[model samples]
Target: MRAPHTATTLGSAAPARDGPAQQVARFGRHVAEMCAVMCVTLILTGLAVTAAAAALGTSNPITGAPAATAAVATLALAASMTAWMRYRAMDWRPTLEMAGSTIAAGAVMLTGYAAGVVPADALVGGTCGLACVAMVAVMLFRFRLYASHAHHAPSGH
Candidate 1:
């Protein structure tokens, strides 16, 4: 014979679902984390671009090609973000997705510029802005991965 079904209490061993407010707060925190990541990425890209410009002769990062400059900046952003994610031991899938999105953003701007669609002057702002939005979108899509700090520490103890 089967045992009778019983109603479980709220404080039972089973994990409780977060309330609506708690869910909102968690989402807010996740957004904030992505913002912080974007900020760090921008700072790293800035330093790299400054050095590149200096090395290339105070003309521009790539000289006579704003699209190329934007590409270099985006590459720097992706590289820094990848290194940071690897250091945090985050899953490779999302990390690569984030980085790939950044690259894709730059490529789009480059294509537009090549097609005479995007103004050369707007390449930097357009590429960087789109890349930042893409990164945040990736984080939002994989909230569980981005929201938790469990894998933040390096793998080795």
Candidate 2:
């Protein structure tokens, strides 16, 4: 009968193992990073909307509601993303995709405002703000899905 190995070493003499605490810590760190990214992206989105509205010269612009909405959305996105990244699990692909989409969306809003197409009402502002929020939400869910995977596999010696 083969003896059950206890200290399984991959390449070195050290035994390969990990405790729940370590896993929790790693998850926490990843969550924090995701949240930070979401927050920053949200802030940028709001700024972009404001700048775009200013270019359009709309006094109502949804009564400037989107400006505030963007601010709150960013925060919510950050928190949600963090939790999702930690508990749901996802991959980096979603994050990259979101980054690209965010840039494109911002550009579109800016162009619309510059071209005098978007009105300064809640319609445009709200739409853009909502879009940004949606993007962040997607990012959060995607990352969460990836983060759930066990990353540090025991290096088999």
Which residue segments of model 1 deviate by more than 4 Å?
A: 1-11, 147-157
Q: What is the lDDT of candidate 2?
A: 0.50
Give model 1's clash tally.
Answer: 0
What TM-score does each of the candidates earn? 0.72, 0.39
lDDT of 2 by residue, 1-157 (tens): 2232336577888755545665456556665565566656556655766577778785533466643443444344545543443343333445345544544554555456557675545334444464556565654565433234343222221
For lDDT, the strongest prediction is 1
Model 1: lDDT of residue 1: 20
* Pairs that clash in candidate 1: none
Q: Write the per-residue lDDT of candidate 1 for residues 1-157, one digit (tens) a residue.
A: 2232234557797544555676567667766665677677677776777786788777555436686678777887788777877765665776789899899999998999899998888888888889878887887797755544346434332
What number of clashing residue pairs does each candidate have, in the order they appear? 0, 19
RMSD of candidates 1 onward, in order = 7.4, 11.2
